[model samples]
Target: MKLITLLPILLCLFTVAAKAQDNNGSNPQEKKVLKLINALPEIIASNKLRMKKDPQRLLKAYIEFTPTAKDKYYQVSVCDDFADRLFAYYRFKVNAATYAIFYDDFENGKLVPLKVWQKHAYGIYSKR
Candidate 1:
């Protein structure tokens, strides 16, 4: 009778374990950020974008600073080629898989929204 009672408990534990294993893909946001990082070279190659710092270095920093949850975000700034004046800033929302990019003239100290990129399903990012 004790073995019969224990059997149901064992089965319940096994079911919970299997469900946890099935939901193992928990880093979707990180993967989305990495996709953006990988696309940097292509974005620069098109001659449509410019950055003062090396793209690879910036990517490394971005990855390090990116947060895992929705409430936290990462921010970085870029200066001119001379590295003397801040020209742009980028804020990344990992949970939402979006970037809020801003540009500043440095003379007026005003930042204007340059673009917003949102990552969609299958790792495609679209400008908003």
Candidate 2:
């Protein structure tokens, strides 16, 4: 009787463990992209980076990620409007398990870094 009851409990535990391992088995590149997305708020707050549109408001915007030729870098494009007129591009870099984010704005047909943040051992650092 006790064994029958514990069988269901053990099966549940195994199911949960399998799900956890499945999540952990996700692609490393995807995980890094997710980490960049999740760190936006903290990075903005820590660096006092200013944006034309409110970051929270921009959360409703359409976002796309493009991987760079370099393995550890990516280009993130965010469109704040349904018409896609208002858009911005950002560069995200991963170094030594740390992340660095940069705003890339085009001027005179050349991309320029407007703001920058690099994750440090203690905290995030701004390199504006």
Model 1 pairs in collision: none
Model 2 clash pairs? none
Worst 10 residues of 1 by lDDT: 17-26
Whole-model lDDT values for every prediction: 0.39, 0.42
* lDDT per residue as tens, model 2, 6-32: 999999987784322111115676456
Instruction: Give residue 11's lDDT in candidate 2 (0 to 100).
Output: 91
lDDT of 1 by residue, 63-83 (tens): 334444654543332222234
Q: Point out where model 2 deviates above 4 Å.
A: 1-26, 42-65, 68-72, 80-98, 108-128
Candidate 2, residue 8: the lDDT equals 100
For candidate 1, what's the RMSD? 15.7
**Global CA lDDT of candidate 2, please?**
0.42
